[model samples]
Target chain A: MGRYFFHTRDGHREIDEVGLDLPDDRTAGLEAVRYGGSLLADDPHILRHDQGLRVECVDDAGKLLYTLLVTSVDAKENLATFATEKD
Target chain B: MFDRDMAPPGMAIFLAKLLSHSLLSTEDQAAIAALPHQTRRLEPNDYILREGDRSDICPVLRSGFAYRQKITEGGGREIVSIKIPGDPLDFQSMYLRTVDHNLQALTAVELTVIMISDFERLVQARPAIARAVMVDILIEASIGREWLLNNGRRNALARLAHLFCELHYRLLDTGSGGLDIHKMPLTQEQLADVLGLTPVHVNRTLKALERTGAIARDGRGIRIADLQSLIGTAEFSDLYLHRDQP
Candidate 1:
């Protein structure tokens, strides 16, 4: 079974997963790659999806710093999560 | 000359030393031990290395904090990882191609220099240590992937929780022990730098966490009032942290 989860730092949350025979394509995983550069960037911003699963980077005063797009996979590595920048 | 008191406090440094002895073996460790002591002090915000620099040595951090950041072509900076006291910086660069990022100090830091020539020669002389070093690099890559997941999919709140949990486990792995409270040295800005959030948002999220009793905040530190609950809140899993099994 493949399960993935994502949410923000406060209280909001979202999760999804698929086991064998579950239909999915590289599209979702590829979407995860979009944020790669932004995650690597040093500013703060928030990145989320229609599902409400989100990732944001902020400072001490609650100001936005940078942003990232997070994704997960259950490949041979067991569980893999990737963080990317939102820019 | 390197001062004995300067090494950072963590498993990363010990792991390096372990590799030095276990991987380098008795004769090689003796050789390295015999070499003249060399050390360097970094001022706050100093760059120990930059992208495109030759990776001639893999430094074992003895004291202070540093982080890994990459500058994009458009002048954007992305912070990938932080180095605590025991961590070794640039091991990946040394073993691989040209450095693709910068290693910069978060505070005035000290580094115990391990010359690449000596290290490589030692590795050649001792395959076990080389293997250990290789394992460490792979572990780093896995951590990178997890950070990516934290940034890509997890919401701001979950991301923060996950980061805290991750740090707690890492610190504990290094023999760092305390109660639920954690003495975090990172400012919100620094947190945002790593988590890819804004200071304002970071503050708001922290406030929410505090209000809910998942965490407590003071000036520069934090109190993890509920560790298990916090982990559950973050939906964190420790499989990727690479701690040695008991």
Candidate 2:
């Protein structure tokens, strides 16, 4: 098992000082996804502000392992523009 | 013939805990103090007992912290209870065949292990001691019910606040140097498991709590800045702890 840090950015950077021990990069990637999901669930407003949520998983030796990102787009605005162009 | 003054470090704490729960006679206290026991030290994450394990021994937390947890098949873990210094680790083993949950060290801990046969014999011989043990077990069950409500109903902020309040009161009851909130043992991940929240949510809720001036962060340690504010936030009630009993 190796130690993995899950640093997050959602309009602000939060560095994880105490990393979790996991088996490999694959597991770390899964953990990052779970962490990002939790962040999004806690506050979905960040996506509404056009700011993407990101979780960066790094190894103990300062190596970047994986990154999980979540973002949203205003599809309704795009649909409205498409309707106007068709007319 | 056991002398209270000559009792070992852990034995005194154990006796004090029982005495707080029930009115044990002098002979009963002496019997407990004289019980044959061994002291063991364990590091964090060490398993004291696992589900389905049958043991003839009972452990008492001499110092530091321990917790009981249940794990799901999907690798999810939920910490059901936190044990503090002087808390008996396995009273259930005396009557039950096997453990139902995992007991693990939450921090570096010292345990006083006694044979279940010996404990059972002493309880049978001393009605007061048996009553004390029963009260202790019932109190634990009461706390468990409150935890159910805390996890199932309370919001994230109230959930975390309620936990802090409970821990503070429990430590105070232990008479084990009270709680130094700055030196709180559980990590954020552990806290998440205890409160039924994720680490990200724990972090965010902590910041929200800090903004209320209920807690202050100094590097890795957190201190209780305004306990009244915290109590208000949690809507805490200590009736479940049963500190007033006996």
Question: Judged by TM-score, which candidate is best?
Answer: 2
lDDT of each: 0.62, 0.86
Best by lDDT: 2
Instruction: Give the top-scoring candidate (DockQ).
Output: 2
Local accuracy of candidate 2 as per-residue lDDT tens digits, A16-71: 87678789989888988887776665556866655688889999998998888888
Q: Write the per-residue lDDT of candidate 1 for residues B71-173, one digit (tens) a residue.
A: 7788556789977666668777656778878889987888877777767776676766677667767777888999999988887788888888887776565
Classified by CAPRI criteria, candidate 1 counts as incorrect
Error of 1 at A71 (Å): 28
Query: In model 2 chain B, which range of ten residues has the least summed lDDT?
Result: B174-183
Per-residue lDDT for B149-185 in model 2, tens only?
9988787889898998888888777676544443567
The weakest ten consecutive residues by lDDT in model 1 chain B span B2-11
Which parts of model 1 have CA positions greater than 4 angstroms off? A1-87, B1-12, B15-36, B176-182
